[model samples]
Target: MTELKKQISASLRKDLEAGELILPSLPEVAMKIQEEVKKKSSTAHSIAKVIMLDPGLTAHFLKVANSPLYRTQNSVQGLPEAIGLIGINSVLNMALTYTMRTMFVNTEGPWKKVLIHQWNEATELAAIVAVLADYLPNFNSDHMMVAAMLQNIGALPLINHLQHFPGLEQEEVETLVEENATKAGLALVKLWGLGKSFEDVIKARHDWMYESTPELDTTDLITIARYHYMKDKQRLEDCPPTSEIAAFRHLEELDFTAEMSMQWIDSAREKIRAIKRMLCM
Candidate 1:
């Protein structure tokens, strides 16, 4: 790397390691929902009660219930109806993901352009990963969805630093520092008390070899989700080959060409678009 890049990375690493950078906290609703979900005795009615306290979240849940993903026999016009149509777990995860997305919408900085792009990419990837659970056995779509949404959260503080510090600008050095975002994000999420599965997905998602375990994991979802994003941008040059994605390599065996991949993204885009509209409204 260049001298300036090296210096920026070193400086960021030092600050991050020394706890000088303040990472953003998970949204309160997400925390509360997680707590509620973890309780073995919690029921749909109980979770809905906490969620109903947040008008925006309740609205989003109702909207998602009406989304094509669920494809209900009829429209869902209320929280109780949504909960009934889409199971408690599914609605809970959607609410949690929407809360995180809303949390970062107000961010501004030198990295705002980068951050928005990354967020959109992540949101789309999260939706894709969630849907992939239908085809990929033993995969936890909820974990993958949340992992894809949050894997780059470390960049939030980095963006704040760049905005507050006049010395930093969008240069090659800054770009390299951006690449270190994943590491910073993993650390921040751990600090926020995220589960081990999400951390594993964040850590291994971009690796060349899909770690072979007894079951499907978030890494596989992230790998495929990223590919979907790149495919949308026609950004083959920006990513590793299909061989790098364990899932993609296998899909290739089933005659999944690049064109077919983009088509899949088209399907994913509809899901993402619907979700984004539902959340925003």
Candidate 2:
């Protein structure tokens, strides 16, 4: 197993350095939405026109606009209205949110089951952070949601090659995922033109005891989310408590605490559940 791990790791790094690895392009809808958003002339109605092209995305947009997470006195009814309810900045995030789920669900090849696990893990982390972001005034929850989803995106480039390996154990697969995720993620994020937020998330996702700055950042939030993700899976048997995490200390300046974290998660259970359902569907 160790030999296979080394062999696979070496091959992947060679391909990465040589720019031979195939990375996924952002979905057309997401790309189009991003372009449209950069235009100072863009409006909810115009954004609606772009989203209306995909029936699935259109439906998901409406559902999100009406979900307990965003809905208020009036239920969102149409694409333009949905875009209005969520704000233009979040429309691209919404488009991304839908397409990522679609990509994960609609995957092909021998590693379908393994890929699905990765999909669920990433999105679940996204959901946790989105809810947690509600506690902070400066951060955007939708943006944080997307950041968490992409934190482990490094694992994606390897899934294709892993399918070719015979008798790869689950433990071996998990090990390889940990070994190459950050490097592979950086390559994909750059290729896709995902920008700085993604670069930061991939770079810091594994810094379990990171202490770079006393100030809180998007990286710190995802770190906290990653810890929660591990804890929820009972994978923290050997890990330290949340209070010990450097990120948690910064969170205190935001009036967030280990106790507040649990309470907020519990209070916003419906919103998180809604997001998970939307992403998986």
Candidate 3:
């Protein structure tokens, strides 16, 4: 590693150890939606009231509600209607995902481009996970989607830290991020109070062989989604065949055959395009 990278890595490790890293805060709108969803009495209308506080999120919600992913025949022209169509939990997940996008927006330097690339990959993986989750009986698609989006979030601060130094190659920075993102990501997830399951997902995402005692979980879903993302990007050397991937093997219980996996990726391509368009807007 370069001296600058060494310094940045050390600093990041120190901050993570001491709980001093300035992790991104959950947007107020997401906080409100999260709080509202936890209550038994909460309804779509109540969540819609909270969502209205953020006009951008409200607009995005409407767009997503009418997206092909939702398959809503009627246009969702209002927040209440959008929320009602998408469900309370889904609204909460979408709002949180939408709000989190702001954290990756950097205005200056090549890092902005890097952030955009990372964000794009994250969203694609999340979209695939959301679709795959639907075929599994007990999986929570919304939560899996959110977890996929966040799996690489730790790379943001690390990349930002590296930007302060001169004479560093983008490849070097990316290598550092791939090495350290999980630790930083888990810490950030805990700091955001997103829950232990999410933290586990972040920590376990790179573990292809990870299998939950009871059944498949977010880690398995993300592993498979990431493999597809790599394959879609034509990173053939980086991705193994479906049969060789542990997540695919563990997915046998869900009747996830190799042919079905291919079909899932083919179907997800369109949804991923639509989702990326909506989120990027």
Best by TM-score, which number?
A: 2
* Over 4 Å off, model 3: 106-110, 240-244
TM-score of each: 0.82, 0.91, 0.90
lDDT against true structure, model 1: 0.68
Total backbone collisions for each predicted model: 0, 1, 0
Which portions of model 2 miss their true places by more than 4 Å? 211-213
How much lDDT does each candidate structure score?
Answer: 0.68, 0.81, 0.76
Candidate 2 per-residue lDDT over residues 1-281, each given as its tens digit:
67887788788788878888777788888889989998999999998898888999999889888875686897778788888889998988788778778877776776677778888888788888988888877988878888888876776777766768866776787777777778788888897787877788888867777755678888888898888778778898756777778888898887778778878777887878777886664
Clashing pairs in 3: none
Per-residue C-alpha lDDT of model 1 across residues 76-179, encoded as one tens digit per residue: 78677677776766655686667666756788656677667667767777777766665556665655677787766666777766675545456652574356
Candidate with more favorable, higher lDDT: 1 or 2: 2
> Per-residue lDDT for 1-281 in model 3, tens only?
78877877687778778877666677788889889988999988888888889887888788878886676666778888888878877776787678668777643565666667778888888878877887777887667778898887887776666667657778767766777788879887877788877877787766756565446677787888888778778886876677776678778767677568668778767776776676662
How many Å off is the CA of 201 in candidate 2? 0.8
User: How far does residue 154 in candidate 3 sit from its true spot (Å)?
Assistant: 1.3
